[model samples]
Target: DYHLLGGGDSKEVYVGWNHVQQIEIAWNQIVYYEDDEKLFTEEATLLKSLNHERIIKCCHYWFDSESKILNTITELFSSGSLKKYIHNGVGVDLVSIKNWGRQILQGLCFLHSQSPKIIHRDIKCDNVFVASDGKQFGLAVCIMDGDFVKEKEPKCTPEFMAPMCLLEMVTGEYPYMKCSNQMHIFKKVYTGVKPVSLGNVKDYRVRDIIEKCILPMSVRPSAEELLKDPFFLYNGRSSTFETCAPVDNILTSRAMNIKHLYLV
Candidate 1:
């Protein structure tokens, strides 16, 4: 039986078994304008074509004319979102951080290498999920709200942290969560002011990476370049996940949580 899962904006999610496919899938049901249904379905098609391991797989989709709803069937990620681990009050070690960072960067690389290039306007821990296999994949991607704009602009969750979401991973908190409002964060970002949480990142390498990521767009490293950085090159083994901490013990099936971004 399908069970209600958390959702954001006009979308709702449910997890249940697909009898025909004989698999568990996360169903994303999004409400769209009747006239704009084509646009939404096209976005779903794009998702279905993606084959990267770090990107969520959209099995198929269908639109209900009378209900003005678009339903997308995707592989279920039972471990939940990265946001859950960060705020779970459990400590995460550097090895876990590095792996997550590298995976996300890989996902970005694949998306950007597309014919016309695809940019996930929204990249936050909430949109990144950990699969049962222990790899994190990007979700709530591409047409986040079923709307596309020719001119690129900042369209992310109001609480989105721009430094590849690495800062939040390191500090275990969201950047600018202290800011009074969205405008306040925009003003700071426009003026090149970083969240004070940047100081909380103890590792110099992690701090340096975050700083470089937050630099002016002109000087920021491409996903490929970032992956080649020294931080991810190290081969040191860590016992963090080997010990199976509460953060790594994600065995139970959980519903996918999707948070919609507010268009800027």
Candidate 2:
């Protein structure tokens, strides 16, 4: 049996424990209230076809006719989502951040390079997961259904959305939010008005990368192109680790301390 981990939209996530191997696994269950069988089938097919180190692995899947529920078992990452990690204030070094950005871009490149090409409409920190050792990252969930792809309008968070997507949403459309409608947001984005938070970023390299990602869709660089950017060329080794004492000294320090006792 699996314990409920968390849930979102119409899906529930569970953590399963294997007594024999003493390991844990993650199961994503999507419950259908309506008779949308095609959606479930397509999602399953897409998940099964995807295989990448930076994308969560879907090992097995099954459907329960009685409950109208679809379940998929995938690898369980211990650190959970990247959004939570950043909010917790652990303070990741620049090297690790660059590595993470590179990994994410690699995953995106793989998806976009496919025959039909998969556009992850919802690419945000919340959907990115971290491994137990914190050395790896993976994209958690995606919407691969035909409706989202053909609709042309993006269904994603406003903050992470590119200006092109925002324009599409407000084109010949009325306001959605009261205080700030889609048009207002689109105007700000289209006119080159950046978010206040962006100015707070001290690193020009990081800021430039972020700016490139939000450019008009017509000019926005593809994932493969961005992978070759100079920003990702920085060696991921931290100066702090490089300046650490030699491995032999670190391993033999305790033995050397006890040597004086024996000599006395």
Candidate 3:
């Protein structure tokens, strides 16, 4: 029997066991809005085409004509999402960071290596799953991600949501927390001004990589190129967990210095 897992604005997730396959699966039931049917269909098609170890596998999907729901069955991860770990106070040392970062880049490399080159617009901690080995190792699986929506007015919510959510949810503040609204976020991003969270990263190598990721798409390094970066090659490890300040503390300390400069 299917049981509720979680849900969002337009979709509800459920967990169920496939009797024939003898495996648990995540059931993503999306409500297909008539106005955005094409977009939904495109997303479904893209999901179907993806198959990689680093990527979450969508075993099957079907549209229910009567209910107007698009149902997709994907392999389930018992360990839940990466977001859970971050929120639960898991100590993220340099070694863990390198391994996780490399795995994420590997998933991105696979998507980018495709003929048309797919871009996962939304690469947040929530969308990334973790498969734990019951000890110290976890494998990351990136779902076909990105939530960029286009309309008459440029919407900056989804564009900034990933970084904002990752930091704000865990630390109670994000880089541009001083910004009052989406328009302010838009201006900050447009001017190539990065969030202060990047500077808070303890390791220089990791910080540099994070900065590179936010560079303009024209100059941003491809996932394949990022995979070869020295951070992954270097074997040296450090105890970042103990030294790094809690995200909230770091942001709060800088709060007085950060001005909500809205130049419009």
What TM-score, computed on C-alpha atoms, does each candidate reach? 0.84, 0.74, 0.77
Number of the top TM-score candidate: 1
Question: Which stretches in model 3 have alpha-carbon errors above 4 Å?
Answer: 35-39, 134-175, 242-264
Index of the highest-lDDT prediction: 1
RMSD of 2: 16.6
lDDT of 1: 0.68
Q: Give me candidate 3's TM-score against the actual structure.
A: 0.77
lDDT of 2 by residue, 1-264 (tens): 888887655667789976666878887776654465666666666777889999887877877878877778888887976655554445445576577778888887887766666656445555678899877899764422212322434334444455221111111111122226656665665576666445444555666776787776678887788779887877545521111111121110000110011100
Writing each residue's lDDT as its tens digit, candidate 1 over 137-254 gives 6554634445444343444443453454887677655667678888998888778888887877766667788888888767888878999998877735553321111233322211
* Pairs in steric clash, model 2: none
Instruction: For each candidate in turn, give its C-alpha RMSD to the true structure in angstroms.
Output: 5.5, 16.6, 7.9
lDDT of each: 0.68, 0.57, 0.57
TM-score: which is higher, 2 or 3?
Answer: 3
Task: Decide which is better by TM-score, 1 or 3.
Answer: 1
lDDT tens readout by residue for model 3, 1-264? 889987656567799999998988888777664554555566666666778878888778877867767788888877776656565577666676667667777776786676555545445555567776522322222222223334332322333423233233223234565678767777787788878655556556666666676777678676688778897766476655432333432110000000111111
Q: What is the lDDT of residue 61 in candidate 2?
A: 82
- The runs of at least 3 residues in candidate 1 whose Cα sits more than 4 Å from the true structure, single-residue gaps closed, are 135-139, 142-153, 158-161, 237-264
Q: Candidate 2: lDDT of 49?
A: 80
Clashes of 1: 0
